[model samples]
Target: MKTKIGLFLVVALFLNSCSTSKTVGKVPLYEVLVVNNDGGANIKFYEILTEANEIMLLLGDETLKKKVKKEDAQKSSFIILNAGPTKETFNRATVQKVLEKEDAIEVYIKDMQKNVEADLANENVFYPYSIIKINSKKQIVIK
Candidate 1:
């Protein structure tokens, strides 16, 4: 009876070991590329382009196509949002998370808070922009 029990335990352990596995995650869930903020006086401040046509229209060129390889015009959420023209060149921004909710994908960003006071007319301005690549194309909203 002892030998039989040991055999059963061995079988059980083998089965368990075969079934155990570590969850493998997809390498890149999303990609972010900081473009620029030179469009300082852009009246249309922040622009998030999720489709190829819109990106082409806004950029008026093949810049987006050149950036992302194997481009999926329908499912590409490319962000060209401007964030600059500030006095501080050392300021920074970070991409926190990108999530898909219903028909839209939200892009979360952490950036240094700007001063409440308006910039003086003569203050040096800088343009800071970034491009976000959503894994699946959909509406890209910045928050």
Candidate 2:
């Protein structure tokens, strides 16, 4: 009886450890490059927030891409974002072209709170048996 009890306890402990060791889909704090394609000469960087709201700086472009070699891109600043599945690479000329575009580009992680806020704000409300439209509009309009 004593030996059997000891074996059971050992098995329970092992199972507990295994369960705790499993990897959950949690966001990690890491940096990513945000190449702005806008015509603005100045380069702007922002930190990405993980699912847990952890922020990390951008570490510049240092990945393997077919066209853009590692040496071609310049390291500016750091920003935080969730680590993506595939690595992204960019060349100096491509970065320049991206910077030259009309829209400003940023690479950072978004938190769950922001996602919730956006979802709550973007919904449409309807009244029962009536044409009542609940239009949730923003106060400020940027041109």
Candidate 3:
């Protein structure tokens, strides 16, 4: 019985240690870039990350929610930026370069648009694109 109890305690401790939640914290600098495809209609592509290495999709934006509702953005499929292709990669160098030339957020969005254009072009599909930038740090929230 003592051995069984010890085993149970060990398993419980192991499980407890394994179970964890993501700790959300403020990054020194973060940016959010959005790309709206005219073809998708209601969806907007977003790429968000911080200098601290935290990156993910943003599904809950009150302002964007309102805009989506007002602008009928629900019909569209909003995609998070994929970090695969060399040109599509969102890294510190690209971010810094954009920040140096123009607004960080603007540069991010422009780069996103350019990436999308290049992607579509590689596929030989032509379409219109629009890029929007939210430069404020408040634009990126950790959750």
The TM-scores, one per candidate, come to 0.57, 0.22, 0.24
**Poorest 10 consecutive residues by lDDT, candidate 3:** 70-79
Backbone steric clashes in candidate 3, count: 2
Q: Least lDDT summed over 10 consecutive residues: which range in candidate 1?
A: 36-45
After superposing all C-alphas onto the true structure, candidate 1 shows an RMSD in angstroms of: 6.8
Q: Write the per-residue lDDT of candidate 2 for residues 1-143, one digit (tens) a residue.
A: 99999999999999988884656874322222333222211122222122221211111223313322232223122222221111112111211111111333232222221111112232231111100001111121111
Shift in Å, residue 44, candidate 1: 7.8
Q: Whole-model Cα lDDT per candidate?
A: 0.62, 0.25, 0.35
lDDT by residue (1-143, candidate 1, tens digit) is: 99999999999999998996899987465777545544443222456666576755634445555655544456565665555556556435557898888988888888772523334364465555666666776667779
3-105: candidate 3 lDDT, tens digit per residue: 9999999999999999988999853232334432223222223444432222212235533443332222322222243322223223211233223223222
Better of 1 and 3 by TM-score: 1
Candidates arranged by TM-score, highest first? 1, 3, 2
Task: Please give the lDDT score for candidate 2.
Answer: 0.25
